[model samples]
Target chain A: MTVYEFAKGLILEAGGQVRSRMDESIQVETKSNPNDLVTNIDREVENYIYNSILDTYPDHQVIGEEGHGHELTQLEGFSWVIDPIDGTLNFVHQADNFAISIGIYKDNESYAGFVYDVISDTLYHAKKGEGAYINRQRIKTVEQTTLKTSIIGINPNWLTRSKSEAIFKQIVADARSARAYGSAALEIVNVATGKLAAYMTPRLSPWDYAGAAIILEEVNGVVTDLLGNPLSLIKPSSVIAANPQIHEEILTHYLSHHNEDISAFHQYLNSK
Target chain B: MTVYEFAKGLILEAGGQVRSRMDESIQVETKSNPNDLVTNIDREVENYIYNSILDTYPDHQVIGEEGHGHELTQLEGFSWVIDPIDGTLNFVHQADNFAISIGIYKDNESYAGFVYDVISDTLYHAKKGEGAYINRQRIKTVEQTTLKTSIIGINPNWLTRSKSEAIFKQIVADARSARAYGSAALEIVNVATGKLAAYMTPRLSPWDYAGAAIILEEVNGVVTDLLGNPLSLIKPSSVIAANPQIHEEILTHYLSHHNEDISAFHQYLNSK
Candidate 1:
């Protein structure tokens, strides 16, 4: 079987575990702060994904949110960027709105990505040179979507005192409506599937968007930093995932006007 | 069976139809504008609920979002306030995040309320005297929650030059996070179930928060206008649903501080 199919199976399995075990007791813990939460399921899920990767492809390397494998300073050959529980707080508190995100990088390039919204039983996957699909249906790029009539995913916390606070607030005011599901992977997949026109977060790690980046790219969706910079799978940064039309509108009109605070913008964008 | 039990079954069945028939093609139409949407499913579901109420309790009065039954200028005995589909846009686009919200009133008082999130198959319900429940588990009133550590449901659209703009922005900033789920029923239900500390919209119709109001009140959760005034069952007004602890804090601290703009706030709060 192709590595992509194997990854898909692994994602579905992990998602099944999450869905089945959600209502049971989970030990919640804090990572960076009170808002940043982790649970035992997160670590266990990471371990499960890591073990499967190692057992199936012994040479493949794994980078995870929890320490489950050798930490790679750089993205080398056949590395998997995995977030066992992308929205751990949501998993712990709400028992929903979380996903298992896996991005397989081959030779330092995007090869395949899978973001499984566990509770909804939706699997979004894509392989390099192929196209993205939500379940079995091939996804299509959005055309001529205007920002004024678009529904965007925005974390409202960024509206206060961030370097892009003004810019972000303007976007929120201009956009049709902004929603925050508190899950980056699902929000990115929302754009890929045309459910949301765009989604932006001021701070997201490599594991959060790596898998979604590939899937969205395959669907002709745009994934980049909030300032329209290319994303790095080895570094954490702000991500703005959108279809082609809205992506161009946001990048050109709202994001490009803020040249004065480029340094502060980069700091806040990469801080998380 | 009690009217409350009868309402519960009716809601679950209505919710079942919404869940099962979600994928089918439905004609979409604009209400006030393009952003305000309604579908054939919305009318069909409203008709189903109205017919069920009429057949079971012909003496009862009903007020629905769609023109389904006799319009009530005043709330009398055994009245049901139903929004056939809350978050119709979410239903049409995302196929999730929408719900069937029913508020049962008797003699001008909230008797029972039910909000069923269709895709998730989760039911939140409460009677006036009894406590609130999610599915079958009784939800408790949250204690000692603070704004600094609380998650709030806030619509960013109010950040424009409205009277409450400054107060709303401060609340968004002071709170740990602000979320906009685009469904008032689910947002209020989120507060009732302790999933969120507080949720408010500048304007909501009677049908939007009627059912949720009963549920919140049952758990000793607070439901009020932005200025802490009691909500009216016969008119559109601002709705703030919150846990027991932070409700006082938000009302006393942020919402009440804007006494200077009370008239303007009143005008904006009920404009929708």
Candidate 2:
């Protein structure tokens, strides 16, 4: 089967597994901190995706939020990036607002990606050349609107921290409104589907944004760091995925530091 | 039919009607201002709700967000308060995050209340003296949690406005995280179901919160204004709906003004 077809099948099956397990008493554990949680469902789902890919492809590499793949020094061949439950806290606590995200990249180029909002039964997917879609209908990114008329997604916790807090607070004040759904993939997909104009956060891992990043980009959205540079797939960094027009507007006006090009930071990822 | 029975039937029916129109192109119109929109669907839904209630009980009064009822000097008899689409913006834009909210009040007391999230098909309902429920399962308000560990629902727009900005920013900073769903009813129900520890917005009309307020109250939550007083059913005011334990905590610590009760403001309703 083609990688896209295989991925669609695996995601639907894993989503079914997640739905069925929602009612059962889940076994939960903490990682890193008390608030950060992982349920057995996450592990099971990640394993299912990992096994399904490896069983068929045999040579493809997989990187997962649950640590499913090898620790590699370089990206090579077909690489799968997945976050089994992007909002594990929402899943464990509210039984909703979480997503199963998977992105398949071949040799550093976007190939296929899918972000399934499990509870809502909504599927957002895209291929390299094919346009992004929510379920079956094709979607385009929202029109470029100024900060005063846009609805952006921003986590409230970001306000407390110092790094980007001051800058983000200004954006929040200038924007029409802000939202934080707790799931990065879902928020990014919301922007792709025109549910939100933009979504920004200070930190995120590859698995957290891989799937939605491609989908957003497919919809003519700009996926970049806070300073309007392409995001690095190997490491976590600040992210601002917005429509093409607002991407530069926000970067030059809202996110820029003294009119300096922030491309210097991205050199680290290329050197890796 | 019993009031509760009649309400349940109409809510589901209205919800179905709303669902059917989801795909059809909707004509939007502005109400008080540019940001405040009243779609053809809102008027249609409000009219349907008004006609349904009045048709059943001529003696009963109906007040709607779309301005269906009369301005009365006295609180008397059975009254139904409704917001056809609680999150109109979400309904018009996202088509998933909005809900239908209805509250039944009698002789100044909260009676039967319902907030149905149409897209998710989740029903949150409650009747006075019985219990609050989500669909069929009985729901209890969330347990007491400190601000440091709580997840709050606050509109980012509120952060930009000055009246409550300083205090709300502190709450946002103190809380573990913040979420802005853009729907008052959904956020209030989220608090009732423990998905959110508290939900606060400085100004919302009666129809915006009437129904969810009853549900939250029945679930052992405290539904009040910013001043820690029971919200006036007649006028717009700052709202803070929280668990019983933290209601006073938030009002006193996060939303208080010089340790004085703001009940004096309610006199305006009496004077009217």
Over 4 Å off in model 1, which ranges?
A16-29, A67-73, A135-144, A260-263, A267-272, B16-25, B67-71, B136-144, B160-162, B268-272
- Docking class for candidate 1: medium
Candidates' chain B TM-scores in the order shown = 0.93, 0.93
Task: Give me the TM-scores for chain A across all models, comma-separated.
Answer: 0.93, 0.93
Question: Tens-digit lDDT track for model 1 on A1-272?
Answer: 98888999999998888888877888988778777878888989999999998999998889888875434667778999999999776776566778899999998999999999888798889998788888998887654578887788887777766565766778888887778888899889889887888998767888899898999898788998877889887777878899888898988998878745654666765564
Candidate 2: pairs in clash: none
TM-score of 1: 0.90
Q: Which DockQ values do the candidates obtain, in the order shown?
A: 0.54, 0.55
* Superposition error at A32 for model 2 (Å): 3.8
- Cα lDDT tens digits for candidate 2, B1-272: 78998999999899999999999999988776666777999999999989988888999988888887748545578988899999888886678889899998999888889999998888999999899999999996578877777778888766655555665778887776788899999999999999998998767888889999999989788888777777766787778888876787787786665233234434443444
TM-score (chain B) for model 2? 0.93
Give the CA lDDT, 0 to 100, for residue B157 in model 2: 65
Q: How would you encode candidate 1's per-residue C-alpha lDDT over B1-272 as one tens digit per residue?
A: 99988999999999888878867888999897778889999999999999999999999999999875445678878889999999887887778889899999889877999999999899999888888899999888654578987778877666644555766878888886677798999999888776788997777888899998888888888898877889887777877898867988988988788755654666765564
Q: Write the per-residue lDDT of candidate 2 for residues A40-126, one digit (tens) a residue.
A: 999999999999899999999899999876476566789999999999878876788999999999998999989999998989999
